[model samples]
Target: MYTPGWQIVFLDDPPRLKPAARLPRRPFQYQRWEKNIFSRGKTHTPVRRTVNICPMHTLSTISSRKSTQPFVHALAWFVYASVIYSANYLANPAIKLGDTVLFLVPYILTFYVSLHLLQVFSRLGTIWTIGGVALFMVASTTAGHAYLFVILPKFGVYVFNPAHPEQFAKDALLGFLLYFSYALLYFFADRNIRRRIAVTDLRHQGLKRELENAKLRELALRTKQENMLQEQAFLRAEINPNFLHNTLNILHAQAQRYSEELATNIGKLSKMMRYSIQTTEEQPGRVTVTRELENLQLLLDIHGLHCKDPKLVLMYIDGKPDGLMVPPLSMITMVENAMKYGDLTDPENPVLISLIMRTNELHFRCRNKVMRRTEIASSTQRGLANLKRRLDISFKDRYTLCNRKDGHFYNVEMIIYN
Candidate 1:
């Protein structure tokens, strides 16, 4: 029968038909071919059978796909063995190639076998693994010496005969020493590398901890600063309302008198209030000395409208008030204190205010006859204390404030350095 897709032919038969022509009979043993052939007479032709094998399924292909670590390790050991054998051959001209190969084969086999055995034994326990490795090293060293001296001579590769006990003992000692030395060197080197890695890791961890601590400290400082600002705002809120209430009562008293002076003092009060509110809103709350002096002049004008003796409330400025800044209302606080507590009616001992500039320093002094009333004295002390706290916060160590009472005069002085 004809196969559907494949062309098959018998080598023993020759036919007169064309190569492309199909045959009706099936041969017992046939070869497959893409093209058919024809012959005119009987002829013998060799039958060729073709088998297709996938390249990926071949042994060489499969092995090539596996990891190369084992092969590389074996190659490295082989190179090491070759080097040692070559060195030995160079030292003694009598050592032959066969003898070198004979020594290397057993030495390499014993070393690798002992190493594998130790690795397996290591899984049992640390103590047992150590003891097993030591035992294996001794046994392998002894066996290597025996194979080199006793067995190799029987094959005529080694010149030393096994009958000589002294030579065998000396060679065995040398082999043991070499093996022990190599084992110790490997152990120490591995341990040293591990220790260095551990120390580096510890230092890295310490640095990370220090960085975290620094971030925590920074966060804490920011939180404390926020709290301080909020408290200052609360204190300012309390002080302003009480001050405005008292000033409005005074304005009401002046309005009842129906005087033109009340209207002018009202304008001065509005300007002072606007300056105070704007200055409070500013961060660090500072104004130029010129602006501060203008506000002070307005405040004194309003107070002068009500003073029993306006001439006794005196102020003196001894320097050019340009390009100099101070904490807002700092100088005015001292003036306000003097007017509230001093005997300004006394012509001989008037409320004296002075602002002087010396080089990079600004000196402010206020002196007045101290009121004998306990209530006014207590309020004056409280106001001065508040001013001192504000000065400490603003200028820190760059400014100085002094308060003294000499007999009848209460003196307040402050100096700020630029």
Candidate 2:
């Protein structure tokens, strides 16, 4: 029930109590055993369950095609061969067992050779098909009995009767003719199967692309929800009144010395308020660079009035701003720190604020005499800490803040993208 960062403590030993019967109990070794189980490295892989909408339909299509051409060819060939053999038995009264054996020899040779040749020579697809047909015709012809004459005497069929050789040859030729038809049917059926397979492959590719796009959209939505939760936490923490108190004290000092300047500063402060209050709710925030500097100048004016030296320098190098937007309150935090901790009351010491916009980025640099570490520890860097958190939540890796102290001076630098 406890992790490395948590602790369990008991004030005093408790009284003895009877153990329950229904609940299971384990020895102290169970705790160590549980730790090992939970401490194992993750090996979870995402499983995607997909429903194939057209598989049943595709299967039925393949079955339909197979039944029509190839199945019919097989059935027709068997039936045709049986009918011919039966008719010859009934009509050829003089035909013997030797005559029938001789008749089947040519048909068997032609069917086996045609099937083998078609498989070996793909470029001769048309020729093979035509040759199969020609073999069928020769087998169908009664004249093919002449081919059997060469082997008939050896078999003793031709010597038995003069018509023996011719009649046996016709029967063999008929068998070859039927087998050729079966081969043609097989070739066309194979082409159709290939086409079906290509269509299935294309459909699978489209489904994969769709699944990938759906996953990307889900990830984007989850990221958006995480950002919203972070923004809500920031707004809840922003309700403390410390920052507003500092602004009021500075404004009070400015009101006594520069009435006209005080009014201008207050106006700019009001405009800044409109942006800052809303940004606690909605960020990524937006403020034009010109507006950001105007707000910075207001704080600087108040600081100038309150300090004993009553002088601070504001300068902009390179170009001025033109409608470029930046994150709200990014520059004012540094300027306030410069006024609070910098040695501004010393006649020789002054604070400098520089605003530069280059390459679609805003640069804020503040320099002052370094305040001691003990002084910073006492007062705490609340404003700088709050600003850093806001920047991290809104801009993430797009912003940077650094504070450096050399021997005599303190420097704060910030870079934020437009």
Among all candidates shown, the one with the greatest lDDT: 1
Report lDDT (CA) for all predictions: 0.68, 0.60
Model 1: how far residue 19 lies from native, Å: 70
lDDT of 2 by residue, 257-341 (tens): 7686766656556555655666545656667777777777667665556654455454555566766666677787777777777
Clashes of 2: 2
Model 2, residue 228: distance off in Å is 5.8
Q: In terms of TM-score, which candidate is strongest?
A: 1
C-alpha RMSD (angstroms) for model 2? 23.2
* Per-residue lDDT of candidate 1, residues 1-418 (tens digit): 2232322222112233564653334211233443223533565343334322222223233355346747876887678777877898789877776667676675556545645554445334567767876787678767767777778767877645567967866765665556445544544453344334434444565598899999999999999999999899878885885588567657856775797667567757767776776787787866788899998998788778668786788888898765777888888888988887787777878889999986667999999897675334677778778777877777888889899988888899999886
Regions of model 2 farther than 4 Å from truth: 1-272, 275-290, 304-306, 311-330, 337-349, 355-365, 369-418
